[model samples]
Target: MCKITEELQQIAAELLKEGKVDLVLGYTKGEQEEQSVPCIVTQPEDASKLIFDEYSEKALSKYLLEESFQDKKVAIVLKGCDQRAFKLMQDESRLGREDVYLIGVECPGMKWGEDLSPFCLHCDYRTPAKEDVDSLLTGADIPEAMQGEPLDHEDSFTDINRLEKMSKEERFEFWKRQLNRCKRCYTCRNACPVCTCRVCVFDRENPDYIDRAKDQMAQHQFYHVIRAFHVSDRCVSCGECARVCPEGIPLHLLNQKLLRELDKFYGEYQAGIDEVPTPLSHANADEPDFFGKEGKA
Candidate 1:
């Protein structure tokens, strides 16, 4: 086991042995040696199965939304990004902060390939807040030399400066080419921690809002655009949606674009850092409407 994985197992075993929490959520080795999957431990002995490493890329926050866990005191392991999702759930009253024990692991950042993920370069929460956590563990921090490096995935938009330099037509063609491969699998939606609707519109028997008949570039664009707008205010930049996409779609770029627009018009905001209302939540009487003129069209 990796050093962090051993430490996590020890901590989880201690927590379970002491009856501090009824369940422990963490990562374990997957079918592939290079991949990891979420595991739930109910017994102290089972805690030994937990592991953590660069391959533990999936966000475990969405598990808390299960009705079975609402009544139980659960202990969960969180990376910097996962903590933001938990925070959003707390802010929205979807989960009670007091009922869960958060074991925050100091993230060095997860890797996509030979380099670090793009989201890690922009992430400010390498560690969770001291007061909110029950226990904090110092795990492997991303190496100093690799700290801000971006994984050079063909679909990477980490160079926001380069993307911004493109003409309107160029940008349109770029996205059109990228989004054209979408199979409408909803893997992105299922992986998102913030997408907590019990009955998502996409899952409805008759999704009137969107064409359910067949997959067209128009429908593909429609699905992604609407989903992007829905989570713009709530996205924590966890990057799970993009990571899970089988088509290699650069979905994080959509979230990043929305975040940039929000920052530009609303004077900067990062969701789930605190309990502040999102830009789309409400408005003050005296607040300037940067979008008012654009709405006329």
Candidate 2:
């Protein structure tokens, strides 16, 4: 096992042995050597199965919302991005802070295939905030150079900027090709930590908000668009949406575009970083109205 993995296992074993947490939520080896999947350890001996590495990319916080997990006193692993996600969940009142223990990781940035994740390239935080977690681990398992340092993050919007340079029709065609491949699998929404709707609009059959007919590309477009807007303000840019998409859709682009527009119109805001009262949750009369209710359209 990697050095940090051993440390994590030790920590988890201690927690489980002491009866501190009912279970420890972490990652363990998957079928692939480079793959890590979420694991739950209720017994101290099982802690040795835990591992930490670049493959520890999944947001474990989402599991806290499960009906089975809601009543348990749990401990969970969180990278910087996922720490933000757990914070957001707490702010939304969907989780009780007292019931969960946060084990923050000094992330070395996760691997997307061989290369580092694109979102990780511009990540501002490689470890969870010191105050935000109960136990914070250093990234000693990674290279000496990659141990939890804040990145410059100066040119973070390069992808969205490239899309902005396209002509209106070209941009339309760009997204058209991307969304066209969507299988309506809802994997992106499922992976998202902030897309926490008790009953997702896509899953509502009573309203039939979106019909999942494979031939209906129009509905596909609608589903993607509406879901993008739905999480625009609350998105933590964890990149889970794009990372988990089976169709390889760059769904984070839609989120980034809307975030930029929100910044321009309503001042800059980082959803989980800042306090509640999200950008769209409130409005001022002075703010520009794109809908043009004053008849400017």
Candidate 3:
């Protein structure tokens, strides 16, 4: 891993030295010894600060949409899932492929102490699969000898299936108990890469659409339910919202349930795999009705 880090730094330095990119987005040593934070290096000499390890958990691609990086050629260090954001942004017309350079890294998974990250456990893509990558940094060949154990969707969906077995009233009660803990911080909304609207519905100044009172159950349910519907088709299951929640809410469960229903009704669909439009992106008379128009409220 140390060797890989050295190679990554060297590449970033070279790109900056050659003027290949105006900015190089990567990770630098965080305040914690074992953690790393997202960094934007503008000078070639500063590229030596870049590092990749078990602590590189944050998705850096989302920063490309920021005003500071806009309209400038940038190079980014990306893992398989992180690279998906580039594809999504390009398809959305918010970014252009030609304006950015990709430094693909083979992810060996990330960890928080002895436990592996939920997103990394469920992921199988070890290397960035994007064809436009300017460079690739390969990890060690030994699978088990590497970092965290890679788990399949079956293992990852255990919580989702448990919720499915409950009766309607029981399910409502379950969510009520969980969401009752919400502080209305909106950390989940801000952390989500797909929640890229210029102005979010929840952040609107008008209180007429939905009440912002944190103590109200109606407000909590409204915030979560509306958010789940908004990202149903676009969610890549990055799990950032759940990770960043201070209240320890399993927010990913909501998105996972929506994904399962979409799969059952319209066949399996994985977002960010290609430029193909999501089901929500189109209107069709032949659409599958998972729930009737008069679904019980």
Candidate 4:
């Protein structure tokens, strides 16, 4: 175990023993080797289960939004991207900072099996600000292969540009092929740390919003388009949407494309890095009308 893991366990144990937190949310070994999964430690003895590693990829902050967490103290382990999600939740008034005890960890760059995850390769914030967390842990056990300098923001779109450069018809066909494979599992929505809707449109039985049918191509397209628009401005580029997608859909690409346009229009904005009133939250009088509709709502 790394020093950070030991410190985290100690902190969690003390907090639980002292009744500082009702639960300590962290990671423990999964059934398989090298697999870390989210777990809760309500007792001081269970604090030994807490560990931080590259395989600890799940975003745990969203659990704070659950009904069971109401009016209760929660100590959650947060990586850089997860910290951004927590910040966004606070900005939206969905979560109160006082109720959460943030145990922030310096991410060593997450991996999917032996390879470094695509999103972590371009990850900007490897560590959270000390002021932002209740307790901070650093000195993550970094793999030598991931020790290089982080990728530049502009150069981060190397893979995304390939799809953007395609012809309009080509892009349509490409999306159709990909979306056709979608089972409408909604894993992307569930895994999204920023998708905090209490009652998702898909979950409701109202027909006016959308039907329960998942077989239609329009149904698939509609789901993605609405979700993409909803999170366009707030996405932290965590890549959880793409990571947890079972169909291997590059769902992160849609959000990244929207974020790129928002950046171009609004001039350099990262969701949690910057203040509230994100680009999509308000429109400028001089805003470009993509649909060429003028003087109309």
Q: Comparing 1 and 2 by lDDT, which wins?
A: 2
How does residue 17 of candidate 3 score in lDDT?
A: 94
Candidate 3, number of clashes? 0
Query: Deviation in angstroms for 202 in model 3?
Result: 1.4
Query: 1-297 in candidate 4: lDDT tens per residue?
Result: 898899999999999999999999999989988889999999999899888888999999999988898978999999999999999899889999999999999999998757988688788787888999999999988877567877677676866788889999999999999998898888999999999898887788766565756677898899999889889999998899988889999898899888898888778888887889778788777876677666556
TM-score against truth, every candidate: 0.89, 0.93, 0.91, 0.94
lDDT (10s digit) by residue, model 2, range 198-256: 98888889888677688677898899889999999988878999999998999988888
Ranking by TM-score: 4, 2, 3, 1
Cα shift from native, residue 186, model 1 (Å): 0.6
Residue 141 lDDT (model 3):
37
lDDT (0-100) at residue 167 of candidate 1? Answer: 93
Give candidate 3 misplaced runs (Cα > 4 Å): 140-150, 289-297
Ranking by lDDT: 4, 2, 3, 1
The TM-score, computed over Cα atoms with residue i paired to residue i, of candidate 3 is: 0.91
* Whole-model lDDT values for every prediction: 0.81, 0.85, 0.81, 0.88
Superposition-based RMSD of candidate 3 using all C-alpha atoms, in angstroms: 3.3
Worst 10 residues of 1 by lDDT: 149-158
The digit string of per-residue lDDT tens for model 3 on 1-297 reads 476798998998998999989989999999988888999899999988999887787888888889988879999988877777667777888888898899988877777457767777677665777474788887633336344556767778899888889899999999999999999898888787777788789878775666657688888888899888888888877788898889888998999888888877776777777555876787777876656888687
The TM-score that candidate 2 achieves is 0.93
